[model samples]
Target chain A: MNALWILAVNEYLDGLRNRWVAAAIMLLGGTALALLLVGSAPTGTVGAGALEISVVSLTSLSVYLVPLIALLLSFDALVGEFERGTMLLLLTYPVARWQVVLGKFFGHMMILLTAVAVGYGAAALFTVLVSDSGTAGWQAYLTMMSSSLLLGAAFIALGYLISVLVRERSTAAGAAVVLWLIVVVLYDLALLGVLLADHAQQIGPGLFSALMLASPTDTYRILNLTAFDSVGQAAGIAGVAARSGFAVSLLLGLMTLWVVVPLATTMALFQRREL
Target chain B: MVNAAAVEKVIDVAGAVKRYGDKTVVRDVDLSVRAGEHMVLIGHNGAGKTTLMKLMLGLTRPSAGRVRVLGADPATAGAGRRRALGYLPESVAFHSAMKGREVLAFYARLKGIAPAECRSIFEQVGLDRAADRPVRTYSKGMRQRLGLAQAMLGKPQLLFLDEPTSGLDPSLRRHFYGLIDTLSRSGTTSLTSSHSLNEVEARADRIAIMKMGAIVACGTQAELSRQAGLPIVVRLGVRSGSGARVAESLAAMGKIHRRDEHRIDLFCLGASKMVVLRQIAALGEVVEDVDVMPPRLDDIYSHYMENVQPQ
Candidate 1:
């Protein structure tokens, strides 16, 4: 267990010290500050709502940026060590190979989680100051923000799985970027296209919900919508008052699946990679 | 100090063979280093020395045959068995992010070396002062020294050092081997694989030489030289203008070659070197030195590899 902690601490230090974390913080903080400044320009509830939308923006950013950060942090986890020849150094120790993998995985996750916590905290504080959404709004925003970080943890583990499953870092990086695009952007766009094409017909959003639940990004989207008082589903589910509760249930189930599945895949793939 | 304890088999290999698909890299090697004897294994490049080292460490498994270290097969030696062994692999690399002290402390923890005793292991390997500095800043020799530091933990009864002194400056090489000698004296048996010909001659209690994956030679340097019929050695030094004269005159006694300026070398053949020693005394001051002994490992190696290889 101490060995596992050592690996985790080492990996956590590596990510925290990484230049990417600095860049992510700079990028995420700049955007949040811009949103706050734009909303404070003397407007009413609609304008206030526009600023509150940063909560939604946080989800979107969490979806896209979290996976990108994850891939950056982990896609070269093993191969980088191997390429640099440090793997030979570690192998001489008595620790099992799995400990090394698990340690690095959790270590990187901790780094991303810290970033998400800081970014979401800033976004939430900005939401509170710029909007008149009150205590209920603040609770909703906090829940969504914390869960977004959990969602990031899941994606980072997924990047770790890709890293171990692939041998070449460039190949892993390319594949992970494509995977992030498919999960965060293209999948939603494709779902939107499917939803539009099905508008004249009647197939229920079952397939869409199931497919969206398959991507952690979509899972975060569902969680934010359900947790923050149906903000995301206002257009799609508000008029259908009777079905709103079911959407909430779908959100919880999807988030649960997102957290469980990727973590399981990462752990299992890590078990098999040599060094 | 390492406690030898009772006699035990530290490394035991049985019919180990490794194949790289169609090419067999190591073929049926059966060898062992017992608990208190210095064993040296020497072979040329591409002679399976590196592969053999890997197999012993469980970094690679043999396609056939068994390897047991400290009564446990390394391929399956739960972490406990590994904790008991210290190995210095050739071309050892270190984590750049870890300072030398951090790396040593980490390995010491893994090896179950008591924390109180860990600092001394670093001291023993002469890395105590630089332990806190990151390994990336270390040179090749420093890294090799760090490798030795890590392997010196636990003071295990057995050690496998693959060219442990390869990068050490000659003074440190002698110092390092002196440490090895002290370890063996205090009861740590070791097998050092090296290409530096004189190292085995100077230190190994028994030497094993490999040719094409087979143990072609094993024993002390003197025994092997005697078996190969290497002649007795004689070195003579002249002041000036007499080396060539001494060389020609010494040719009457046996095979003579000018080893260097002011030095005449003769191979004693069919007679004691005392006969040539008497004549060379008349020829010059014999100012340098003359010693009559069996051929050195350098002479025996060339005679064996160059002239005695084929039937």
Candidate 2:
């Protein structure tokens, strides 16, 4: 445990000094603020609450942005160390292989969490002050924040999986970008195409919801946009939400599963690797 | 005689074989290092020095045999037992963004040493002044010194250093070996691998010459020289313009090669050195100066490496 903490702390310090965490926070916070400003402008004319509109825009933004940030932050976590020759020095220490994996995962997760909290938290605070949002708006906004973190963790784990499976840092980086495209951009497009082509009533709502849970980004989308009636009505997913039977807990559980399974696989592969 | 039981074997490898895919990096080899002994491993590239070091350090498990460090299987040793060991790789790397002090403190914590102890270690490696500076600004030698400092943390019972002095200057290399000498005097067993035989030749208590994934020779300098059977070279400097005369007089004594107008070299076997010297003395005034060069580590290493290579 002590060795784990020491390794984690080292990684955290490395992240802090490298300034990527700060840059991520700035990027996320800046984009959230911009979306809040642009998104709330229509709330005054349309009579919709500012916080509700902001949550809708932010959910869409997170679906595109959070996974990219997570991948960029973690794609080179293991392979970079190997290329730099630090891993060879690190393994000679008394720490186990799993500890190194877990420690790095926790450290990168902390960075992602901090970025989400500070960036989205600032936007939420500003929206609450300027808009006449009640308790439900706050609850929905908080849910989006937490789900964004979970989505980021799932991708970060994916990045680590790539980091360990590939032998070169450049290859891992390439794989990470391709994975991001497949999961965040292409998966939803493919799902929509499938739904459109099922004109003969072949794929029903049950199969559709199950398919939505396959991608972590989709699970996060369902959790924030469909789990609550107010957010779902505002985000225009109410029709799908009424048809889907996935509970809020089940969606969150799926997201958590995404985080664990890939990370566990990374640990197993790293243990068997010669480095 | 000292009690044999009191003496400890820091590292033991018997019939160890390491293979990556179809190519074997380390063949069946047996080696052991006693406490406080400074053993140097000399080999050319692809000679399996690094693989042997990896096996002993538990970075990789041997494919065929067992390895023990500090009397325990290093591959399966617990953290408590592993804490007794330290290693400095051939190319040491650290987080470039971290300050020198922070880097040392991080490694110190990993080694279970207090962060405060990093100060003395920095001083020991002569990096105290640059301790507050980031590692990116450090020179190659300074980084190597920092690596040395990190390995010296917690006073490990066994140290495995590969090319430890590769980037160091002459004076720093001397100081580095001096530090190793001090550690060895206090009973720290050291197994260091190097390509430069001259640097470690005088300092090593025992030398192991590796060739083609196998140890071809292992012993002290004198023992290896005897095993290699390489002849010593005796150079005679005669009075100006008398080199050919001296060569002729010493022709029957040994194989004499005239170097120039004033110098001639005689190659004689180890056992016939004294007899040849007596013959050189018989020339009296003909010989101006005499110098005998015995076989050094490089000669013995080349002899073994050459003999071990397949024709």
Candidate 3:
């Protein structure tokens, strides 16, 4: 356990020295502020509070950005160390293979958490000062920020799984990009196409919920946008959100599983790897 | 301080075989290194030197047979048990963004040692001047020094260094062996792998030459040289006027490899080297100076590597 903590701190410091933390903060913070400023124009016409509207807008933004950032941060974690030859020396020490896996997870999650909190926190603070938003607005905004982190964690775990499965960093990078496109971009479009073409009304609410839960990004979107009445109505998903029938706790549970299953699989595979 | 009778086998491998699929990387091999012994594994590339080292380090388990280090199964040894072992891999690397001190401290921490002890290790490997510099700015030699420093941390009882001197300058290579000698004197057992036979000739307590995933020969330099039965060359610088006379008089002694006005090279078996030398001494003033050359580690290594047929 102590070794795990040391490795975690080492990885975190490496991220800082590599300027990954700084870059993630700048990218997330810059985009969040941009979406907050230009996107708040619709609040007056829609008759929704500023924080609630921002939550709706940011949910759309995070579904694209969070997974992209998370995957980029973690795809090279294992394979890069193997290529650089650091992993060989590291394993020579008293550390177990699982510690190496969890150490990287905890460290990269800290990076993502920092970016999400600071970036979305600034936007939340701005919304509070400028608009007469209420407790409900603040509640919805906090949900958005935390769920975005969970969403990021899920993707980071998936990236580590990719890292462990491939032998080369180049292959891991290619796999990560393909995984991102399938989960974040194409899954939703394909779902839309399938639903539209269901002239026989074959796809039911249960099947739709299962389909949405299949992709972590969609699961995160369902959690943040549909869990609240004002946010769901403002994002124009109230009809679908009402019919989806997924409890907030169940969505949170599914998000946690997304993080756990892939990370556990990564640990098991890395244990048997020669390096 | 450890007595000879009380000496332990720090590393023991018996009938160890490692196969990656159908291709066997480490054949049935048996090796043992006593405590305080400096054992060097010399081999060509893909000769399984690194694989053997990995087996002993617990990084890879053998497909069949046993590997024990410090009297424990290396593959399943606990963290506390592994603290006694140190390894420096071939072409060691660290996070390029980390400082030298930071890299050492990271390993020190993993070994449960205080980070403050990193200062003394920096001085040991002569990396103190570059302690604060990021590894990205380090040259290959400096990086190797840093690698040596990390392996020397916690005063480990066993050290496994794979090609530790590959990229080092001659002086740095000497310095590396000097450090190994210092550790050996203090009762640290080291098993190092190198393809450079000349560098380790005088340093290793015993040499194991590996080829095609198996050990062909292993012993002290003198012992292996004797067993190989290679000839000893005796070169003599003759007086200006006696080149012809010296060659004629020594014609029946042994094979005269080369002879000229300035020198004569004669090759004789080890058993007959002194007999041949006495014949030269009989012509006292005709031989101006005599130099006896024993079979070098290079010759012995080549003899074994070339003689062993591939399985």
TM-score of chain B of 2: 0.92
Q: In candidate 1, which residue ranges exceed 4 Å CA deviation?
A: A17-53, A134-139, A191-204, A233-275, B1-7, B112-118, B211-214, B226-229, B234-290, B299-311
Which candidate leads the pack in lDDT?
3
CAPRI grade of model 3: medium
Model 2 off-target regions past 4 Å?
A44-50, A134-136, B1-7, B236-253, B258-264, B274-290
Which lDDT tens digits does candidate 1 get at residues B10-110? 77888888888789877788887777889888877777777787777776778899987666676666655566567887777866767888777767766
Instruction: Tell me how much of the true interface, by contacts, candidate 2 captures.
Output: 0.70
Candidate maximizing TM-score:
3
Off by over 4 Å in 3: A45-48, A134-136, B1-7, B236-253, B261-264, B275-288
Best by DockQ: 3
- TM-scores of the candidates in the order shown: 0.80, 0.93, 0.94
Tens digits of per-residue lDDT for model 2 on B69-155?
777777777766667777899979998989899888888888889888889888888999999999999999999999999899999
TM-score for the first chain in candidate 1 comes to: 0.83
lDDT against the true structure, each candidate: 0.70, 0.86, 0.88
Candidate 2 positional error at A119, Å:
0.7
